[model samples]
Target: MAEVATGTTMAERRASVDLTDRRALLACQPDDPAVLAEAHRLKETALLDFGVRDSVVTSWLYAKCHHHIPTTAVETAAVVATGDGGCLLLYNPQFFVDIGLAGVRFVLFHEARHLMHRHLYVEPELRADPVFHLAAEVSINHVAMVRLASGGLPTRAVPDGTGGTVREPVGVDPHEIHRRYAEDLSGQGRKPLSYQDFVDTDLVVYRELKRMHTPLVLPIGLCIHADHVGGDIGELPTDGETVGRIVGEVLAEAIRAALRGNRIARDEVLNLVDRSEGGGDRLTRMWGTLGAVALRGETPRTRRVQWWKRWLADTLASKLREGERLVYPKKQGAVLLALGHDPMLSRRGRERTKVVLVALDTSGSMSNEVVDWITSLVGQTDGVESHWLSFDGVVMPFVPGERVYGGGGTNFQNVVDYAEGRLTIDGEPFEVQPDAVIMVTDGYAPRVSPAQPDRWIWLITDGGDDWPEHHNPPMACHRVITGER
Candidate 1:
């Protein structure tokens, strides 16, 4: 988990609250400072306990979000993505104090799952449906219950017919909802899904709910997301792109950590990626960008080109074509200008062969198939001068099929030295400056910064460190999934 930011005092948080609207001000009353302080303390404790006992992914994600205690601006708890590339966790202070620590954990987990669900199912139409909203709530709560091992939903204090208050479950019950589905489906002479299959995926839940003729199970208590209560409380409207980027970065870091031997993180991330498949286009694209190869491994032979391969091809194309100049078509420009339109310009690159350096770390095990794949990819690209080097402690140029031998200590600095023309192999100088440098290594050596970090792309094999991604002035780094070899 990332370092937690310093939190604001109760007074500072209350002062920042927006109370401009008469109705909103009336709807949201400030709680006592002592109550607010207690609420904040409870929330902090809940988050800490979550890190120790619950999902590491959630722990990492919530650490990156900004927590706001805005009195009753939010009825319960909500996580909203700020348009400026950040996430905000808003909560009602009084509600927190009332629900206590266990309740706080449940709510926090529920809200985090909501954010993940939003990122996965980004289609506007899908979000606008009320049935989908209920289905999402049901699915999230069920998962939260099973994962947290709370044995039951969190309860909120509610006023009884008498003077005293009693606690009631705060969200829809999955079992109750499932029961309703079963009854409704039986009446229609159709079979209902088992609990496991019903909650298989968010889309599956929605589809099953759509089949029910009975009314959906609405929450008896607060559900800020499904109730749509947080949008009007001065919270920044959720930006899909910002949410995707934030979640993507978190998941990517989690995957890298898993590769570094965090068993809990690996299990959680792999399960998430596995369940999230076929969710939606945005989810699929985001997983692809994060390299599902490390999580899902290689699919069947039918899935010829993996997501990382496509990503590398696109990234290389962009990198190698960096210096291309845009030119305004003179004839078309004049014609468009006369018709009151902006002319479309075309990009053209200088007619020169692009130089590319490929370094393979011989100390680490790399399959011949992978080497052959890289060879074909680089070889087939038009007008690219490719240099292949097999290195462990020393740099040595070799063809794809040539026998390369090295078992010495790994040193990445040696590759940098040779690439920058500062070191010679067998008294032969490397004169050409590479347009891009592709380093395929296990990444167990000392880190080195190249002359041009932008031109360097690091591909760490399975069980390898991806430290370059978090290096000072980070470079393009990815994990290459090597299965069985």
Candidate 2:
């Protein structure tokens, strides 16, 4: 029953969260100690089956910590907590009756999500609604629909320990169970049922003699990918139009909750929000890159910009210094793929070759989010000429795999100095100069650099300070305000 300290760093908090009470989740059953132990083991197997994360499972367990499970098979299942501790749930037996083992597992996880995440805390009366029980029913029926659609189920029923026939559980195929579970919640079956129907069925089971499953959307392929890829794929892919709609609906609900002045944390909303709102692909790429970077640094936002610029710079520098040429590797792919090409020329060869140089400023004012993201982008690609420049008083192109160090000053002139000998953008044979230069900074640096007649400069910053009008000539600059300032 040890809880994590609230103010610790994210890494520390994550480690603590992962170590949450497995025994507590097991403490729910009032059965014999052996049976309860078996239940705890079964829950672990179920979490694995459902591809739930330790953090998420821990959170669930903590929420469920306050309430004990129903004592008997015939007793009505009800959630007993409120505000931060509340959840609306019911144990339905039909899912268990109809779909078998998967039904039981699906409901358990679904109900756990409600109690553990405190989904029922949103309202006061939901716990009393018959619909509470239906949560699991709809969830498992959805599983049935999906399983039935994608060929067929393998084991419909298993042996009841007592020679009596017990329903085969749905938990065995949690991924598939979640998928169909979502479909059922969406009311996609032949005789369509409302959300109320799903809930009411659970009520009937509680009132009558019967069944199991949790109600929640399991977007198609998500369960498969989550189970295989782990819960941290960053962003979930849009699974066609149907699943996309469900994701959208889920996002809308989250937003509505936020707008209602709920105290839900921003990151939690972000975690649950639709992956497509901003740039899903961009966010995923950025997250993957950040995850690779070391945890020490500034926050996510600052590190993202810094890392992106660094990636652009280092990658560009590596490609250029090696004498590699950027080319269209294949017309099918949209991005330019730089490759080492022969400098030897035929009569038909063109004399001019384009090169790109990128520079990033890592200053005390910059955030960690930007830095980590930049590092990640650097790691994902090849053949691009990238240069990472960290400046306070001076600018230097970053070496591959080097830790960035800078404090208190920045000067663009070093960029000019660094490129002085080898590369001249003006078609000078003296050196192979960059065709374009990209500069990333917080605009806290000296603005002017020595003149380069043919260089293109793209500047990205927070835009607090004005650009010096006396900047070097023959330079066309694009200024990007990242909104951080």
Candidate 3:
């Protein structure tokens, strides 16, 4: 901040600002006492003949209260005067954040640049000329930021609305950024610009922003609420922390995906070694491994299988003929043979197989894309009963007649309870057993387990966190990824 690089003196720079020209350019001058005072203070900072104030620059700022801009603020918009009539500056950070900083700055600069060039006074060049002017404004701001970041501001020419001599940032393309921003805006049902054009350039900004710890929580919250309850679920609560909580839930789900292996990692038992209460006995909680798996989204491929041991366990129903009593397939071959046979239809007095309880994750992260697919997996056969349980933080029995909805938290244990209940000998004595308990989830489920159901198939989309990894599941557990068999 001390050394004036490029050997440029402040006076020389101030001289180029042309306060008189700027005041003359703007038809109006600041009238508000507070703003006027600030402007005067800024101008007076030019002390010892070493001046400051970069080109009577017009800036934009916005004020919001009760979801509406104050009348006083709008009235203040009429009062910008930089001595010389230059550009009228409006400060609107909130608007820019919503519309994208680069875009908003472009519009502000475009209008300011117009005033600087006296385009406003001339007969309106087409009613829509303002649009082009706005674009130019965006271009100017973009060029300025890039120049500043690259430490080449003084030498670089700003991009004009039309092509100009402005040098694109070194190793930081902007086309893609612009295009993506445009597309994102458009996808929200707004006017869109070409996103692919400067995608490379935009990534630089995105990376930098990410490095700076920019808050992505709000946008993620907006997306979740939009996808879950509907985007128009009233204005998002002003409390950003609540929004962050919502995002945390979503991000947690994404984390689950990274921990487990891809779909092929399915149909295996989780290793609940860590969660076991010493002595390597039964696990105190299955969620420890599941949580670890969910958190291991970026785990290396070689180590994924090492996290758990998978075995195709005994099948639910053994080969039963008419009057042939249930002979639990204790051997792996019997289990495999039973699995090979269709459990739905009865052949010559064969009893239909008990229903398999299918649990589905309905977290906000489990977008409809995954839900619709899981729904399709529900068996429609009259003999083979299938049940669906959709859950987030908690679980509930998905009654056959009810439509699947409401996703936020995920608790796989409740789903297991429902499946176990059906498998019990009777819903009363709990002796019946299910053929298999299939669970499809993003895998951030809470840690809990009911009585072990027969073959447990965990078809995870995102890797699951909190899946037990101590004692391996007694049955075969396969983790099929989305769109996989």
Candidate 4:
């Protein structure tokens, strides 16, 4: 086991605190300075222990989060994303002192896991369900138990029948939840999943729970994370978009570290990606775009798409959807017109055929594989009219697999000029106004400004300069790796 430094200072910690809200939260009842200091020390010690022994992912996540001890505001420990693009861990000082080191570690690990869970499962309807919330608790706590090797959950001292006190498990027990599931499913004549299969993934756990005939009553003393308040959990204070960005960045860095030969990080990162499969289209695209290749190594070629292909498709979809505004549904509008009345049915945006211009650099640098893939993608996509061009020192209109000879110097300006209607191809004016202009090129060309840079997307090849990313008005640029040797 190796020790990892958090790299945060006292000044940075203080700066992360929201001063105005801190003042208002603490106005009711503030903890003694000494008690708060002791709690902070205990939390730091637990985090250090996790870095060395428990989990690198947890250590890395909390290292980036700001810790706040608002005694009265948080009943227990909770991890929240702040509006300022940072995460905060709120804990009660007295609660920490009572729980001691082991309890503190368990609670902190639980909260960190919640942040990860929220990031992976972002559907509004799913989060609103109480069964799903309970399933999340069961899944997370099971992982925490196995990782920490704790015999049972964190406990609190309660009065025994004959003696002073006894420490009992204080959180939802996965085994107990499983027993209830088994009993409920049996009554419905449905086969229940085994404990191992039940907690396989977050989505699996949720789906299985939804099959129950009798809803399991939520256990008393369940952690605040599972308690539904106004159809939402308590720990999620920040918006979904912000939380996704922050967590995605953290996971991306963790994967990079894993690739750099951190064994603990590798295991944790891979497990997360494996478990998050089939959660949603957005989650799948996110993991694919992030680094599923490097994390899981070679994926078998089947119906599954390569990471770069998914990334390109997602990017193109966003580009094509630009300037869309919601309008009345056509069916309703037609009925209203026939009945001679005004239709106020606003459903979705009108479907307009989008034009996409893809110019491939033909200066002995273009890959036929990439060209073929692009052709298939654009050709299969409905409601899109695609124009293919091959450009070097000059521009030539050609379809995929049609070789046009051009060994002259690379000039990006020629492609821009042609697309913007300044240059003509074969004595015909470029008439179509493209919604997205995709340029596939090598680095050996001078950069030129396009009229609508916002609609421009640059895909730089291997060993190519991606100057479009750093231009005055930076355009959308991505590295194009064919992964062919």
Candidate 5:
């Protein structure tokens, strides 16, 4: 190995970062408070105008990047997402003044979209390709125009090589890109996609352009993420591989907030969440960890022909309903996003598996069909623990389809006593405080209060007495209805 002699060693290189760069890193904002306040105002306006969900995320991305100290470090507003998730927005005040109000909106949205694209699509194959960066600009600029209601391409102030900056059109218009592709495709006599179909997703732009004979011609200026060949001087990621993981954590927190009824966060998750979530495990598994509030089909589904299923699903759902307890869902939600689950309910995470007890009244001819329904219902749902019991005068712990010898007498106290943990089966104490206790009986037993009356649910068979309903402090009582459901 040849040792090339340079005056500066590694130590000198480490210490030799420019004073201007040092000042920029200090992150001190000794600027006009009024102007800084306007920056916040611009963000709020963008959020309101960008709809609820997107605004929540855009706001979140810029939440910490508030070191608005005026510097000519870059021409426009730029967010530097560090190796960690932390990012700071640095904008040159004069550059902003040159671009005007509309351009400020453009810059803010454009930068945010860059972070979003980086976060949601971080497969190594996509990131390694240079074309991905150009395709991203096309998508973000098009979306910005539509979202900001800016009729055409939004412009930005670029350093004019003088003491100040000059306003210039920011990104390559998708319309113009489409037109170029149109000409090339026409020359080859191949059909081109309509503008609507062409610009649907970022990857769409990448794919269509790859087929074209002429290379994509991008503009020169400040694009926050593009490399040096594109002549982009804005902040670039030192390592892009971490963008997905760091931003993934942020996305999960946003989803949790959305689940907790943050409207903006919800809307944002819909737009910002990945459409092709092709991972192995389904997201519902993780969402089930959030307990009842995160259950699916709780919210009204789109109007469809299978309306009866909603009723059936809801009926089955009630058996697994959560008890009076709150839980905050944390990493399970991140896993949910990775597994591709959208926020379905409005509740924080709770600590406990959803416990469902189905006590079959073996004293009479019980509905084997009804028992099958219960078994299938619990099977379909995630995060549910099933505890089965069969009782006549005595309680016996049994599996759902297990045959039991009953028909002796109906003493409902036996089941209630077992559920409240006062009694045991096979000489072992059943100590689990179930979130839901379902008793399927012919309604002939003397009604007794379980330890948690509110947690009890009575499912009376046909020609059976629903005595528990008339009891003071009535429990959740429903009928099996004895039909081929």
Candidate 6:
């Protein structure tokens, strides 16, 4: 349900998307093995080239998606960000051959940048205005041209099967789109932005477009999911929020990777971080949640916990689905309908609401930094109901910033009982089982089996014993390393 640059009716946009869906991606090679092999090779080379050029952003974005679906549904290539913090990069093999290497690189970079800009993470306000979408398309294309350093459109043919070639123009060129805007504004006796100034920031493009009587609308074929009218009509974009989170996580990951000797990843991440909202406030918040301590530029000696938080975040995302949901009725519904989404409203709630149990064993050994970190982490996380337990010999529920009583011998059993619906909070006994149990403690206490062992995720303090690791049945466990920086 996208607004066609051709000014087609909403009905027409929906119909076109329906026609495209019939061309769903082929999971594996069909009759010709040679074509599939060549396609794979091209994709590999593109990935390599992209990785070499901008390692951090490209690497993280590409890894977040699975790109094996060969589709005729999309004219060029498209990405469907899945509900599970993953993405589907569906493309027509012929399109790859069509655009050639330069085009492919541009498209891949375009898609990743869209993710970076939280493009598909469309909000109601942004979607209600077509000018915003147009601005985004222009900005995305402009950024691609600048970064890839492509002088002109790369519509050169790349060889396909049987000596045939696919030579197709890729996305809407920012220059051409800007030229249209410039001409329209000039006719209206209004000054237009230069190409450089026009495409400077994501919001700037929209603000400038609003200054014009009629902004240029590039056709749907040009970009990925640029719509108040979604590329997938009728369905609400449920996974968009999750995709947004994943995008941040990956960007932060890339930045950390860049810091740790990934020169290519570093350059791209710095560029992305620089251009982000609030002058990289979004990245700062993301890294803080991830407990990515290296962003503090801590001394080289104590930065031993680089990859642990990434691993922890990924693990927790899978198991910690909460019961409640948020609905976007007006704009999100309109946007999804514009895309012709199947279910109309993207309904995304589980049967039961899950409670998160954060049992902090506040023994003398536990650091305030770790406690403060966990408090911030839990405070920022939404959607799930969190129960904080500070325990030593006895289990007791406490609120954030509430001083916890401890110094007694550690008692892991009491924490387990409190989490397993057998304990009380504020004099009220728990009635339901928790969905996930996170224990922050020094592994000095005896281990007891919970009703669900897999739901138990234990974080042991530095140099502390990890009893769960040596238990009869192992569970999810990680070391919470403290630094002196």
* Candidate 1 C-alpha lDDT tens digits along 398-436: 988899898799999989999999999889978999988
C-alpha-based local distance difference test score of model 4: 0.68
How does candidate 5 score on lDDT? 0.60
**TM-score of candidate 6 to 2 decimals:** 0.45
Candidate 3's residue-wise lDDT over 1-485, tens digit each? 01111222212221112112223223233345455444333322321112122222232121111111112222111113221222234322222232332333333333343444333333323212222222232344355455334332112234567876553322112343344455555556655434333222323333322322111111111101011111221221122344555655553333333434433222122233223337432232233323443332334322342221121121223211124235443454344455453222222444666556666676634444444544454443335666556666656556644676765656565566555554232243234466666666655656555465335655545454425432255333334444322
Alpha-carbon runs more than 4 Å astray in model 3: 1-348, 367-382, 399-403, 421-433, 466-471, 483-485
User: Worst 10-residue stretch by lDDT in candidate 5?
Assistant: 1-10
Give the per-residue lDDT of model 4 (tens digit) for 303-374: 344444555676688878744556778886676666555666464565679999998887746567788888
lDDT of 2 by residue, 320-361 (tens): 343433444343232212222223222333334445555677
At residue 99, candidate 6 shows an lDDT of 64
Clash count, one per candidate? 0, 64, 84, 0, 11, 12
TM-score-based ranking, best first?
A: 6, 4, 1, 5, 3, 2
In model 5, the runs with Cα more than 4 Å from the true position are 1-54, 62-71, 119-121, 156-168, 226-485
Residues 1-485 of candidate 6 have per-residue lDDT tens digits of: 22327342333322134221223345323456665566666766776787534643465466666444665555666565554655666566766765667777777777777767766557766754556767787787777777789875557564677799865455666677777779889999988889889889879888887776755554645444533234443333434456577787677567545644457876676566446637555555654454443544543233345454555565566687545454556775664456454323444665555567888887836666777776666566665678888888888888877888876787888777777657666777767677778888778867688777888887877777767755667777766665543
C-alpha-based local distance difference test score of model 3 = 0.36
- TM-scores of the models, in the order given: 0.43, 0.25, 0.26, 0.43, 0.40, 0.45
Choose 3 or 4, whichever is better by TM-score: 4
Q: Give the higher-lDDT candidate: 1 or 2.
A: 1
> Comparing 2 and 6 by lDDT, which wins?
6
**Model 4 ranges with Cα > 4 A deviation:** 1-23, 26-31, 53-58, 119-121, 161-163, 217-222, 225-485
Candidate 6 or 4, higher TM-score:
6
Cα lDDT computed for each candidate against the true fold: 0.70, 0.40, 0.36, 0.68, 0.60, 0.64
**Cα RMSD to native, each candidate?**
24.7, 19.5, 26.4, 23.1, 20.3, 22.3
Best by TM-score: 6
What's the TM for model 5?
0.40
- The candidate scoring highest on lDDT is 1
